[model samples]
Target: MKIARLSSADIHWCEDGDPQGVPVVFANSLGTDLRLWDKVIELMPKQGLRLIRFDKRGHGLSSCPPGPYSMEDLVEDTRELLKVAGVHSCIFVGLSIGGMIGQLLASRQPSLVQGLVLSNTGAKMGEAAMWQERISSIRAGGIDALADAILERWFSGKFRQSDECLAWRHMLTRTPVEGYIGCCEAIAGTDLTASTSKLDLSVIGIGGADDLASPPELVRNTAALVAGSRYVEIAAAGHLPCVEQPHQFAGHLMTFFKEDLHVTKV
Candidate 1:
């Protein structure tokens, strides 16, 4: 269990693959931890990449600070984690809220991110009112009250019937309430359309065809913000394609690394 003590929190992280290989950093969605990428990582080529996965301040094993954190706070946590891990540059793969963090981070510090794989996310998520309503629901009844609804948005109907879906339910409901709500507040206040449109970095957006949240059109539109970005939609998957369709997801990542970023084994 590796941990980086940043100014505001203790981030839990893990490293894999060749130390000298090209760097790839993964940021997970809200209500999830570093384990969110476990299946995707297993499918990735192990020879030529340095894989870094970390829990955000309010999620996973990382310490949860006070409520109502900002997007800037999340980005700073990622920046400090990378600095502590000795990663000067990397291809960042982010899902859901993680993708928002990726967008803002790339805009603010382009040199640190060589490329981005934005999965099931957008520059602007739902409206503040909607998020606030969801926040109120969670606060009133706890995550369990909304777990079924959230899971429906997260997975395809077929996947939801499987036992694997139960595990995700557990993961979601187990998330600290304050942490989840804090991220909700961050998402509520963030609108990165202008900043994302100005990014000159290489980017590819992936979305689940069955996704209810951050639908394919939304992901495609966000990708279009960058002049030369690309977009792909995975069939039979929902919000978390990395979980529901990891092989397809990893294939996209490998393609982007070799073709777009020109990343090759060192």
Candidate 2:
């Protein structure tokens, strides 16, 4: 229920675990809110780890502004939230558009990002025309118009037929039109390859084998941008692997933090 009242936009957010523990900030995908990380959070070890999740402007309970938000706008919103919350240094885990935000933030403030995990995302996500067409469709018929198609891209066929898929479908369809379109515009306009390539911090790129939105190849290529970044693929998962395979998804993150970054208590 916490809210960060940034001048540009009010952001909805929540935090878990010890305040003094090693900080880990999570940024969700385009259409999902902080709840997107719930299952993964539940599976993660709590001791000596601080986990934080937030709803970007126009998504979840956050205020919906005008259309066409820039990647810089999203990055600034995160920066303000972390500053107001007194979060100093941390590892940032970002999914989809969330990964783009992480790249921009880390490039701008390296001291704040100790490590990074870019999951289910790429530096340059999709062509401008594709996003524009989606935005147009959303504006005309609202989020429900493309809900089924989006879900197909987000999850595998077997998952789409499962009973649990209903809840996720609701999550996607219920998102505000302005919010969804705004984020789409941001993705359409962003290309972070040049900046992300220069990152020197610990990095890991995670992908789902069946992720149609951002395929494994795209994630692998994005990871290659950073000289020493490692890449892992979670089998039998789609775009939102954290939802379909929470344990496996969380395991990848924990392994990276513990083995590579020397984070304690996982």
Candidate 3:
């Protein structure tokens, strides 16, 4: 684990496997840290892949920037974080807001991205009013009220009653409200219509079959906008399916990145 400083924020990251191996940079969804990828990493093929996971600005141990961030800010921070981490370029695998940032990163700086795994995210995110309401609620009170709503929507009803669901409540409680709102604003303001149409990289879009946030239809639509993009859905899981169904999620990812799409000569 390492904390790399960017001009605007601190990036908390973890690296595993050989330095010379295929670099895979993992980014988490809004309001969460790199730990979101823990189960996913455990299932990743170790033969040829080096895994990297990081927390975005204002989240986890990373520095908290002020309220609201732009996609460009997130993209710049990511580029600098990778540079400071001694990474030149990598195959990016992103979830939710991280996925949105990846789209911008690949579109704006093609050289820095090789292949892409965009999971549980949409090209253009939510409506402005919806995010504003969320931010307003957090500002009025805190994440407590919102956390329950998020959890209910993120995990299926069955999972909510299980032991696994209890463990994640802490993750929700410990989150920085400032960081959550910042990402909400970013999602509210940004539009990825251009990037989805423009990004010319090997891409795979994955979603949870039962996801409330980014549903299967949403994932399919997002992928269809991109030229010849592959799409897959993990069953019996919701928003954070990577955690709930790690084995199945990783299986889909491995097939997409390794077996399905041929990587360009690196």
Per-residue CA lDDT of model 3 for 1-266, tens digit only, reads 68887788988888876567778898898877888989988887665777888888878888889977888889898999888877777889989898999989998889888888889988887799999998999989898878888887688888999987766877876789898888888899998987778878788889888899878887778777778788888888988889889999888877777664553222
Model 1: weakest 10-residue lDDT segment is: 257-266
> Which scores higher on TM-score, 1 or 2?
1
Q: In candidate 3, how many Å is residue 219 off?
A: 1.3
- Candidate 3 residue 243 Cα shift, in angstroms, is 0.7
lDDT value, residue 190 of candidate 2: 92
* Ordering by lDDT: 1, 2, 3
Model 1: CA > 4 A from native? none
Winner on lDDT between 2 and 3 is 2
User: In angstroms, how far off is 201's CA in candidate 2?
Assistant: 0.8
Give residue 143's error in model 1 in angstroms.
0.5
Each prediction's whole-model lDDT (CA): 0.94, 0.92, 0.84
Cα TM-score per model: 0.99, 0.98, 0.95
Q: Can you rank all candidates by TM-score, best first?
A: 1, 2, 3
- lDDT over C-alpha atoms for residue 241 of model 3: 88
lDDT of 1 at 167: 94
